[model samples]
Target: MPISRLSDLSDRALAPRLVIKVGSALLVGKEGARRRWLTALVAEIAEARARGQDVIVVSSGAIALGAATLGLEKGGRGSLADAQAAAAVGQIALSGLWAELLGSHGLTAAQMLLTLDDLEDRRRYLNVTATLTRLLDAGAVPVINENDSVATQEIRFGDNDRLAARVAQAAQASAVLLLSDIDGLYDRHPKEPGAQMIPVVEGVTREVHAMASTESNSGMGSGGMVSKLQAAEIAELAGICLVIGNGQHERPVARIIGEGIGTLFLPRRSASARKAWLGGRLRLKGSIHVDAGAAVALRRGSSLLAKGVTGVEGHFDRGDPVAIVDAEARVVAHGLSEYHAGECAAIRGLHSSEQAEVLGYSPRSSVVHRDQLVLK
Candidate 1:
């Protein structure tokens, strides 16, 4: 069902797992932390927890916080090394403050710093998701941030908005709320006269993207409205609803959730559809050719066991997506490989129990698990 009203969202039945993103501008000030705003935000989080919803926060502010602590001039372009050093210093203070503030509300906060590699690698992605799931189950609110200290331009996510979207996908969250400086997406730049707010977005069309082109002037944050729209697209494709709203007001989260004072992006696909989209989105790194019997087994929803694999083509690492082909060279499915191409080649046509003898140690019985496979 398409959610067109805020009343649909306030039901709580619609969103069980929620991921909220807080930009640096909302969390930091010229002097230091924004205590009153932080308190209200944490209070809202506590209220949500009391209502039995699992909430995760994706926060950004390390660089800005670090720069302030080091007495570095703000709004100045700095080198990558300088930014990294600031992040290293800021992460400690940022996480500490999060812990302290959440603690005051009697909620435990678990800090998680992640890099792009963590999500791109299947094994690492699973590990991160599992850890987050465990933390939520233990009643701990996981506060995640990008690992800016070690990230280079080539490896960084660039903004917490996209990171939050990826986290929503990995955690299988129901919704993602991006709290920024503006109340919501506007048809024109909000500062411009005659700008109109877009209350609901059923899908992120090219037209919707045009509204976000105005670069954000928020001194403490890197992302503008463009990044939030990008995140909305990601979240929508992952079967998660996304909301972009202002965080400067008291009880900002509550206002967004209860009053729906933001631009809401609805999920257009179902969970299975989203998974199929993901399976098809990645470029195939290699091919695993299987025998006739194995192909039939696959059709019957069986895992791709090592004994069934006849050949491994291309050099690819574990967790890389690979096409599963039949002997006729027809691709049947695609999935993340459990072993490197070289290791898979060595284990081809061997029984599951014989894997240890062939490779000295076997990581998994199946080359590609059924759960990971998406049939054409």
Candidate 2:
């Protein structure tokens, strides 16, 4: 089969569904300035819609623009209260701009704000999916962003890159386009001598780690190459094709989908809702220390057996986040707990079948089922 170019793909039948993530850097420009890209972006989306492509846009600009409007100079890490205030200011301004631009293009844009809890909880996750599906079905473009205005540190998505990946997974998109200021991932910063462009990344590793600089290059975004790579890894695991490229060029979205101007990361073998949830859901809240044999079994993708658990620490209930730790107390993976810490302690050394005798009430046999566990 012949290789398909980005332009070819764009001009071809639009994908069944696509998640377009526009970074703050592109939306806010340099020094937290707004640009004309929104107009062009709306045009491209309109074109895609005309071609029968269902598109959901995950946009970042609230914090950047909010800081600028407030004369804060930059959107640095600030107190939670302060950041929330900035987001409140920015979200209002950002959504207004999107509504105006998209309206001019004869497209309606609906703002959907989300927090980590909404994506992590199974019911809420499905609800979000249903709403986006309805919006697309109604010929509306769902404009998604992290619920920064009201999200606390405990429930925040932290960054838009991660938020986009989760949204892509939830929407079950066929492709995710990550638009940034930089063209693509490079072996070294292009500004430096002898830097080479990497067109395709199969998977992220230390080798590829050298290809990305550790810091953010965007003046208006907190995301850097590292975060993009991490986001790609998450999206790939969710079986979604991820493309990274620049949004500054004329028709960059069209070019990235059509001409192939950026780096493309292929999806993994397969991804399930459970697996994607495990990998992208709740942050590790505590550690469950297990013996060596259990650690080896977990590495082999087996479920956590009660006999392997040595001790449990911290507070976590059923469906709460917890880490699977080795005897040496190193985190090997993270997953949702089947039981609380006290319950787990009572049954730590018991066999799976003997759970009822130990805990008085038995839930599932495995402490953390393989499907609910994501290895680090």
Could you say which candidate leads in TM-score? 2
Q: Worst ten-residue run, lDDT, model 1?
A: 273-282
Per-residue alpha-carbon lDDT of candidate 2 for residues 1-376, written as tens digits (9 for 90 to 100): 2123344335425347888998877788555545466778888988887777788899988887777777664473466776777888989988888888888879899999999889888889899989988898898889999988889988887778878888988887877888887878999888899988788877667688777876667655777888888788778677777788888887788777666789887764446776776676646667799999999999998999889999998988887778898987667777888888888888897886788887777657698888778875
List per-prediction Cα lDDT, in the order shown.
0.82, 0.79
Where in model 1 is the C-alpha error above 4 Å? 1-4, 7-10, 75-77, 271-376
Question: Clash pairs of candidate 2?
Answer: 6-257, 6-258, 6-259, 6-260, 7-258, 7-259
Q: Please give the distance, in angstroms, between residue 281's alpha carbon in candidate 1 and its true position after superposition.
A: 8.4
Regions more than 4 Å wrong, model 2:
1-14, 30-33, 76-78, 188-193, 206-211, 289-292, 299-301, 310-313, 325-333, 345-364, 374-376
Indicate the residue-level lDDT of 122 in model 1: 62
The residue-by-residue lDDT of candidate 1 on 269-356, one tens digit each, is 5446434334423346889999999999998989899999999999899977899999999777787799999999999998878889
Models, CA RMSD each: 7.9, 3.3
* TM-scores for all predictions: 0.74, 0.86
TM-score of model 1 vs. true structure: 0.74
